[model samples]
Target: MRAQEMWKVSDGTGITVAVIDSGVKDVPGLEGRVLPGVSFMEPPVDHPDQKYPPHDDFDGHGTTMTAAIVGDGSAGGPQGLAPGAKVLPIRTSIGTPMAFAVGGEAAKGVRYAADHGAKIVNLSIGDWYSMDKIRSAVEYAQSKGVLVFVAMGNEGEGNNAANPWAMLPGVLGVGAVDENGDPLPSSSHGQDTDLSQMGGKVLVRCKKNSDWCVQDGGTSVATALASASAALVWSAHPDWTANQVARVLIQTAGAPRDGVKRNDYVGYGIARPSQVLLNHAGDPGAPDVDPLAAPAPAKTPTPGAEQTLEPRAESAAAAGLSWQWPTLGAVVAVCLGLGITVMIKRRRRRR
Candidate 1:
């Protein structure tokens, strides 16, 4: 990713990314950076004792993702890809019973972020089932000119089933790769995957505390980095529309080794933000023409209809390493790759 060099040119200033996940805490590194947002999940009826606030993290996964995107490393936490970017923390339940009972929570969160002042929305979660409510929300975000990035899932070595959110049109599906620039076996793949990034053996802030830890790799981490990469590019080119920013990311990504235009494993290749930030590469195509296919028309929600959705497991793999701060100099480089090529489909554009 050459993040250090890219920072010299643009440290993601004037950009706000919405992190829709478990929740984000006001940890040391993220003290003044995390903006207050809403929580879609409430305490379950059966487990009233489990009340998690919007700023509270249930699994620490959200905090880690937040840190990866914007942590300043002030308290020995992991350095963010876009240190100057601000984060809007929107909390949603994933592994809770309330998540299953409350359908369209993710949709609500996305809409909230878009209505607010977020230019980018990062969804580091995935679900097995596809819900119309969520799809409509994603389309709504795209219509609002907000870029949404989602994890493709970590079941690559298993069923590798498609994640509904990642499959949504106009959303950038992200996959994971390791330090060696090889795709991680656990990173899910499909035609929807638009980019890949360094996720394996990366350092992150632990849940419930400010300590640093290492994550073996997950599409969740890759997705957060992809969002931050967009922040860097958008920060440098504030005048560019969402379509133009998306175009540059795809155009500047590393080409696939097989010489094909795109592959299931790594998409266009890897997202190389440095190609645009440091080297002044990539073409910011037409501001109105979407680089990815345009999204389908949004369906109107039924009035007063109470929708319930089943929550799928999160895309992040369990943390394998124990919490401990390692030497900062020994940290592995967070390399980003892959770019999107314009593959416009003949779908009806959203109004």
Candidate 2:
């Protein structure tokens, strides 16, 4: 493909993607491009309202993944798949060695996104199983028409079953691929998951004022790549529903297997976002119909699931300004006209 070919066709210009991970740093390429995000772990202290801050980066992982999805600046790393799209960084993970510890942060991020109005939610996280709170969050996003994409987890070598979070109906589970288009050792696999994208070896934004890049692997990268792909597709086909986009991804995935058969390793083959963005894939069926409607509550936090207050919460700022406003570009007219684009953020900031 041409340099930023996907970007030219669709730069995720109006899309607002939430980066749920170690806070994102404000890199030169991403400066002005990223909006104030949420930080759940840190107490805002004087800045009580801002649980999350704007253009923050901490462990470098969030920024790296953010670059894959939205960075277009040639600072010192690889350009993003969708340079024009805005990023809403959420400090969901502390880059901890364990996964359960971050599940709370991820849950907080999901609630914030749905409440704020992000159209597409990008979670470059793994190990947040698809059980109670997590499933509720995913269900809530789907009810609001938000298309949530998550990393399929980096347990492929350990024979980890497809990450349950990815298998959730409305959620898009992505796997990792090397530069040569082969599955990575760490990328998880499953059948119910959405698709696959480039996750193995690549460069990313280091931080603000620094254009330096680094090499990395894991489903986290794949999730970022897939998030950018969704932004491109959503930005172009403004009317397409979340289901339609998801259906296209599955229909056009790299390898097709009989039924929903998932290998103990790679999931439903690899996701080919190019197919949907390029309109080469088949229709995603119903616009109003949801793939995740069976088990979970229509919106979540309904009956049996545990309920908790958001780690942080804030009013929206402006149209296309919130980490939850993934459809900002698509709904800018509606939001601006209604003066409803209040991009408030709750949480903490890092780096």
Per-residue lDDT over 247-339 for candidate 2, one digit per residue giving the tens place of the 0 to 100 score = 666556555233332332334446555556555566767787654343211121111121111111111000000011111122344334223
Q: What is candidate 2's TM-score against the reference? A: 0.72
- How well does candidate 1 match the true structure in TM-score terms? 0.81
Give the TM-scores of the predictions, in the order they appear. Answer: 0.81, 0.72
Question: Local error of candidate 1 at 158, Å?
Answer: 0.5
The lowest-lDDT stretch of 10 consecutive residues in candidate 2 is: 313-322
For candidate 1, lDDT tens digit of each residue in 188-247?
777777887766787655544456677664788888888998999999999998888888
126: Cα error in model 1, Å: 1.7
